[model samples]
Target: MRRSRKGQPVTEIFKQLLCFFLHGTSRHLVFFDTLAKDAGYAAVIESESTSMLSSHSVKRFFRSFRWPRIYLFRHLLQRMFLWRLKLEAPDVVILGIDTMVMDNDEAKVRHGVRPTYKRVKGF
Candidate 1:
């Protein structure tokens, strides 16, 4: 566990690992602030005046960076979910399903679609 200037506990390793998505001081997204807020470190980050990065700058570092990889972000998210699942269910094999139906009627060339669901027996 790492702490912010005001002594709030944060997963510093995770934050450093995520820095791979940022290119430079001017090019990045405002994700860290949101992360800090979500992870309960917003107050710590906000109070760090002597830090190299202000709270807003730290959050938006990705927007100004060059050629940040989006795939890395996606992969990190997937792995984080899997890791959390393992931590919560160390000895159990959990299976789950998402039954989400998106409104894709506007798509001109949808890849996969059942013209009609046999189970629903409708259009």
Candidate 2:
């Protein structure tokens, strides 16, 4: 994995990624290109001393993570979820699980492509 000078704080990166997913827009890394041009998003994520990272930087940041780091992140998230559940103690709780198959026939050269039951190439 390639590492560069730390540009944005991890918190800020998480905020940007969360906002991007919550926006219900295209689920492509290329969306970062459009976001780089969105002043409104910059205003929401940027601070007086720090600016949003470029699309390339964002992509690089994600590419640096490995399976061990991802599993650690998942463990941390699960612990946080349990803490929140204890604090809230709601009468009812609902959990959801879903999977999405992204079609990648046009980009067969990309990694992780495989045949799916949907009769298409995807990841």
Candidate 3:
């Protein structure tokens, strides 16, 4: 599913995103600025140029994808997941997700803030 469009390939962008989540300090785009400066981390992406993509470039790349393309990517990911499961062939497949409560009580003006079960103000 490689596109002929110029610039970074889809796999490279996906690798950058994976690296971002694995090494990022915070769950924000600002972390990309720090990641871009790390030579050791840049090598992990295995790209021709040992340079990390900027947050702006990543944002632009995400914005460029339409709903249909995004759905197609999701389907591709699902297929990959199924293929990996087949290869692993585990006896018991237990799926779990961890959820965290973000506290935003310090904010002066809360737009979409709500009170969680913990009685904290956050999404």
Which candidate number has the best lDDT? Answer: 3
Q: What are the runs in model 2 whose C-alpha is more than 4 Å off? A: 1-6, 45-50, 99-123
Q: Pairs clashing in candidate 3?
A: none
Question: Which residue pairs show collisions in model 2?
Answer: none
Using all chains and alpha carbons, the TM-scores for the candidates as numbered come to 0.30, 0.66, 0.63
The 10-residue segment of model 3 with minimum total lDDT is 43-52
The best-first sequence of candidates by TM-score reads 2, 3, 1
Ten residues in sequence with the least summed lDDT for candidate 2: 45-54
C-alpha displacement of 61 in model 2, angstroms?
A: 1.2
Tens digits of per-residue lDDT for model 3, 1-123: 335565577778888888678865679987777778877667666654444777887788778889999999899999999999999999999999998888889999889778985899976
Model 1 stretches astray by more than 4 angstroms: 1-47, 52-60, 64-68, 90-123
Q: For residue 56, give model 2's deviation from the true position in Å.
A: 1.9
Let me know the TM-score candidate 2 reaches against the reference structure: 0.66
Better of 1 and 2 by lDDT: 2
